[model samples]
Target: MTYAEILSHIYALGRFGIKPGLERISRLMAALGDPQKNLPAVHVVGTNGKGSTASFLSSILTTAGYRTGLFTSPHLISFTERIRIDGREISEDSVVHLAQRVMAAAPPDTTFFEMITALAVLYFAEEGVDIAVFEAGMGGSRDATNILDGLLTVITPVALDHVEYLGADVPEIAAEKASICKPGTPLVSARQVSSAGEAIAAKAAGIGATLYRCGSDFDACWKAGKLEYRGVGVTLHEVVPGLHGRYQSCNAATALAAAEVLSGIGFPLERAALVGGVENASWPGRMEMFDGEPRILLDGAHNPAGAEALADALAEIPRGKLVMVIGVMADKDREPLLSALLPLADLVVTVSPALERALPAAELAESCRRQGAAVEIGGSVAGGVERARELAGADGLVVICGSLFTVGEARGHLLSRPFEAFRG
Candidate 1:
């Protein structure tokens, strides 16, 4: 199949729509010879920061001279962004070939995520990667990526998102995510709410996995104007993270701890690699910036916790009036999301991505109005961003956010890039 045709097939699989089980994926992987078995990997799971942590860990492993594969989701612009080796996205031709191979072995009940996850593992094994880093699509235990036997599991701050599918609150969500902690595996976790921490601790203890808490076992912070990281027996100063936002410091610290664990477990990772990796790691659509008049910041902060982080980051940057282009999905907690950013925005240009799941522009605008925000309906993601830039002017700032789909559309618009046909 050609690239477009294969992408269509992959997207068509979405009709299965998030079946919450491992049986289908297991059957598909078994049909494809179980390529995920024994692959040295680091599995990253959380409500937020999963991509950033996986990016940092992948870069660190790559910097240490290991051929690394990274599998992430919700591509910002192109489908190729979902799979990468050594920081390079999989080529279009490779994607087409791999999609074909994966589809052939896929079960009739296979979901889009399962097929994609299978393709990633198959590609990594075929390419002979020394290690791979996978970001869980959702809860860890039944996530498609959970098929891999990762040497370490990293849980970045769990929060209340995916409630219907995962659970109702922090403890329930944390337990679902923490289920990725395999027996005897080293599980590194970021600082969490007490409930979340306790849930994760219980899971680790129950499974006999050694738990490493961020504050108790290691930490990262700006001390006397320098970034410092204290890991499990390894201390590094001047640990600069390539990503923006204060929340990223915690994510980086978690990755650093995981790296330290990998090093101890015969990965041969060194200080130089650890420093270089965090310094160079990059995750797009999360506090990503584009230069020009009225510089634009792109962040996919669909949840309240993520919105709060974006708001905090915006507070630190010096700018004139803040014009925000916001688009969120229909199922998200819109009130809490808007509450975090509405007060900070001088103007909110509401838009909807070209997606079936997106909340309509009028609905989003109504929500913004209810919050007493200065809101206007911009119809589409591109229109909203363009309108926001005009409102922001050269001296002001424009932030595009609310969902990855929104960021992806704005990014594609600003860069004049074509998007892939598939999105899930």
Candidate 2:
């Protein structure tokens, strides 16, 4: 099929909606000859920070001279962003070719995510990657990416997200994410709330998997002027991880811990490579800022936990005022998200991201209004960002957030105008 035809076919499958089971994915993999078998991978599971941790692991593996494949979800701009080999996104031609092949072989009722997961595995296997890192699409237990028996499982902090599919409470949600652990595999987790930690530990114990908690086992910190990583009796000093945001320091540490664990299991990872990898890992749309008089910051803070992190990060930057351009998905709980973000905004402009699931701009504005936030309705991302920029002029700041869909569109809007001061 052509690229447009391929994309239309894939997106059309969204009508099937999120099917939370592994039966179809397993069947699809079998039909494709099980490309996932014998593939060394690191499965990243959590409510937040999954993409960042996966990016760190991919960077570390690649820096150590290994070919690595990275697969993430919900592409911001292009479908090509989901599959990457050694930091390079899958080419459009490759995507077109793979989509046609997989669709022909897929079983009836296969989902968009499952088909994409199969596509990634096929590409990684064909390319002969040394390892692949996968971000669990949602709850880890039955998520399509969980079909792999990754050598190491990295669980970032667990939070309440995708409640309809995952679980309603933090511990229950944690249990779902913890299900990614295979028998006797090494699992590394970031600092989770006590209940989440307990649930994860319980799940790991039930499965005979070795659990390593952040504060108790391995951790990284940016303290006293350097990045200090302590993991598996290996200490790395004065390191600087490539990603922005203070939370990323912890993510780098998680990646380091996984690297050290891999080394114990016979991966020839050198010290220099670990140091270089941390310093070079880059994940866009976390706290990405363009240099300008009034800098534009794009963060994919769609949920409460992510929005809280964004608020903390925004608090640190020295700006005259903060004008936020926001959008959200209809499924996300807006109360806590708005509570966490409104307190930091001098002005809020609500927009509808270019997506089928985006919450209505007027509804978002009403939510902000209820919360006592000074709000305006921009209706669209481009218009919202323009309005925010106008409010934040030169000396202030325009922060675009609420969802990756919003930030993605804002990035395009800002990046396209060559005359905009924020343009690179």
Best model per lDDT? 1
User: Cα lDDT of model 1 overall?
Assistant: 0.89
Q: Estimate TM-scores for all models.
A: 0.96, 0.93
TM-score of 2: 0.93
Instruction: Report residue 377 deviation for candidate 2 (angstroms).
Output: 2.8
Any residue pairs clashing in model 1, and if so which?
A: none
- Writing each residue's lDDT as its tens digit, candidate 1 over 30-100 gives 99898888588889999778889999999999999999999998899998999999999999899988888
Question: Could you tally the backbone clashes for each prediction?
Answer: 0, 0
Q: Give residue 112's error in model 2 in angstroms.
A: 0.7
